[model samples]
Target chain A: MYCVHTTALSHRFSASQQVLKEIELAVPTGSIYGFLGPNGAGKTTTLRLLLGLIKKQQGEILLFDQPLHLHRLQLLRQTGSMIEVPSLYGHLTAKENLLIWQKLYQCPKPHIAEALQIVGLADTGNKRVRQFSLGMKQRLSIATAILHQPALLILDEPTNGLDPYGIIEMRDLLKTLNTQHGITIVISSHLLAEIEKLVTHTGIISAGRIVFQGTLNELVSRQQSESQMILQTANNTEAAQIVKTFVSDVVINAQHISMPLLSKEKIAALHRALVQHKIDVYEMNAIKKELETIFMELINQTKHD
Target chain B: MTNSFTNCLSAEWIKKRRSFSSWLVVVGACFIPLILTIMFLVYPKQILDLHHSGQFWRILQLRSWETMSIILLPMGIVLAVSLITQIEFKNNMWKQLHTAPVPFSSIYFSKLVLILLMLAQLFVLFNIATYVSVWIPALLNRDVPFPLYAINGTDVLKENGAYFIASLPLISLQFAISLQFKNFLVPIGAGLVLVVGGIIAHSWKYVYMLPPAYTALHFGEASGSTKHTDHNLTLWALGYFVVFVIIGYLLYVNRKEKG
Candidate 1:
């Protein structure tokens, strides 16, 4: 079953400027779905629409098989959301803040200690929130969201101001929350590298539209442009010509001539021909794929579309 | 609804207790009455005949409570307004309340009650100050005759109690205004201006609704006369309150969440 589903969701800021146009989104149950987009690409807007924070100009949203607008309050009880900066009273302590949230939610079990512990703020309960660091504030926010152990957690840029250690800790906490507690997470962020490691599935958005939505493996496999390869040889021009027969797109600008291979067998045949031609091959290797590159490619494709 | 209301009340109280503004309000509440008492003693107002104990008590009733309301009462209102509304505006606290499994009425009303409680605190402190200024000097064998007047066993309680009750409509109106503008200075400044304006407007008989200043103009009148004006008091205040509250709630319900 889909945890959150949005269809033809359209919203406009004023009568003239359109924010989101015919945006469709779906998140399957028990999947850590990463909503990736650059700044102002409508990631947060989409999340807000799904959660019913703002009224949609057009379309329908369903969460847990119920219409979001009709069942917002009921649906909110089963979902936890941390959007933008965590809003907390600076005067109150961490425990006090959590207690306020507990009262608001009226959760049967307060989970004050456990939630604090999850965020590693258990020892700092008595200290006022004003004294806490930015990373600590983000963690406390996470704790507030999951205090009731909701089935789905929606976090928008949860690791914004964290140092390396803080980022690692947040990553580990999210992993534990997903793996141990079996809570589905829908996180939206611009950090491709961070999302690449944590999310099981991703939806890349640009200009208020979903450019790509699939698993990371599928993302890497769908690159029909070329498998960027670097062949090191003494007779670079000769090897480039030989590779051109096996690979359709070949470029020989320098010593390292790059080509797109149709298959491994074709590359092997090219290698045999190179050896027979006495073209001393120094190195041949495929470039390692990175999500950043994939993201740029997808965004470029969307811009063209 | 009841549970959520209580929870929201407790949450607001907790926030208010820890707030610097709350402390400032309590300090201001205490300071305003104390300063007025000192000014009266040093300047020596012949506004009322202090020779008679009854007249002396009336002076305290008329002067201290009235003076405090001019600036201090409105200051208290501004404090309550700022403390309640600024939290949501400055941070994303509204989001927490927005998504919570509670009705909007609970969140809105709790803050309203807290503002009322703050006003109540100010009035209580004013009464205590009246007792000290009037009764304490009389006990110390000062020339003043019965500094604190006891009118048939109940003195300030009977007189000021009516005015306090009349001020409830003002409390609701000020709270509505405070919620409308999250800024502390705006409500505080506006309230101070209104109090001053109300005093100036009192000479004109048509100026009916401005309770704090008008109540000051006719401080110690017969029950029948006070009762006649009570209609003016209740109608105008309630009218302002209903309009303010309805407008405030509509604005609240229609407001969109900010990041």
Candidate 2:
């Protein structure tokens, strides 16, 4: 069953500016769904709508088979969220802040301790939140989100403003929440590399629309079809002529010739042609596009269209 | 549902604990009495003259009530409500609180109830301090007869009770404004301007329509020349409280958190 599903979701702040347009999302249960978008791409807007933080102007949203608009509080009871910055009372201690949520959720008192331990903040004793470093506050927010033992966790840029170690810790914490706790997570991030390692499902949004949404492996496999073979030769002009006969759409620069990888045998045939032409081939390798590259290509393609 | 309400209140109480702004209300409540004590100490002859006329408590009540109703109470309401609502705005806690499992009604009303309780505490503190202000001078000046009979406890309670009721409309109005604006100074500045305008325009009959002016109108009723109680002003205060509270709750529940 899908944890979250939105159909033809669109939002506009004003008559002149449309933030989200015909956005659709399907997050499978027990999968870490990465809501990927650049800044100002309506990823935050969509997340807000999902959590009922913003009013949905148009569309249908279903969370756990129940309509979100109809069952917002019921659905929210099973979902925990941290939007943008960690919403913490600076004057209160980390433990005090957790206690507030603990009371609101009516969870057992010990769950607060458990959550703090999970976020590695169990030792943050009596330290006011304002005194905490940004990473500490982020962890405290995650602890608050999970203290209720939610089935779905919605985190917006959870690793933002974290150091390298903090990012690694956040990634591991999210993975543990999904795999160990059996919690579904929908995390949004602008940095593809930050999310690529953790996310199993991805929905790439551009200009307030979902440009791509599927499993990470599905995305990689789809982009793999466009993988290119790079050939570095001693003689570039002769190499281009020799490789053009065997491969269509051969692209050559000053140092190398590049073309789509059509088949495994095509490389062998091209090598034989280059040897016969005395155009010495120095290197030949297939370069599969990375997720970051694919994300940029998708955004750029949307812009051009 | 009752459990949820209690839990919500407990959460709000936790947020308010150790909060500098909440303590500011206590400080503000005591400020007028401190000023009154200093006035009695510095201007003994002036106080003695009122005592000679056998109207010391009446004059003290008038002075204290005027200062509180015209100046301190309205400004205190502005500051207290601003601080209470600013907790959420300053920390950007509105979205987090709204998205939580707690109902929006609980969130909104819990804050409203907390502000009311804080204001009530301030009223009680201010009254106690006023009595202490009088007691200090009486103890120090052995020769000057203590006007114990003049400072009737029931009268003080009645006056303060009236002041509290009169201030409710302003509290509700300011609470809404504070929640609407994120900047600390915006709601405060607007409140101060309205208060000054309310005081200056209190002579006009239509000025009673202004919620902040209800304090000034209550002060008018307390002065001996006017009747001790004005039923019309009381009804207006109640009307404004109900209307503003409903409006405020609706606005808060409908408020969108873009971040």
- What lDDT is reached at residue B172 by model 1? 65
Record all residue pairs in model 1 with backbone atoms less than 3 Å apart, i.e. clashing: B134-B147, B134-B148, B135-B148
User: lDDT by residue for model 1 over A111-205, one digit each (tens)?
Assistant: 98889988899999478998999999999999989988899999988888889888889889998999999899999989788777888888899
> Could you report the DockQ of all the candidates, in the order they appear?
0.52, 0.64
- Chain B TM-score for all candidates, comma-separated: 0.75, 0.90
lDDT score for residue A14 of model 2: 93
Tens digits of per-residue lDDT, candidate 2, A1-305, equal 89999999999999999999998899999999999989999999999999998888899999998998898878988999999999999999999999999998888999998999999999988889999999989999999999999999999999999999999989999999999999999999998999899999999999988899999998888778778989998998878877878876998887788898757787788888888888877999899887789999898887787
Each candidate's lDDT (Cα)?
0.74, 0.87
C-alpha TM-scores of all predictions: 0.86, 0.89
Which candidate number would show the highest DockQ if scored against the true structure? Answer: 2
lDDT of 1 by residue, B136-203 (tens): 44454455455433543366566555565556555666666666665567866776677678767766
Runs of candidate 1 with Cα error greater than 4 angstroms are A108-110, A223-226, A232-258, A261-273, A276-279, B36-52, B55-59, B132-161, B181-193, B209-231
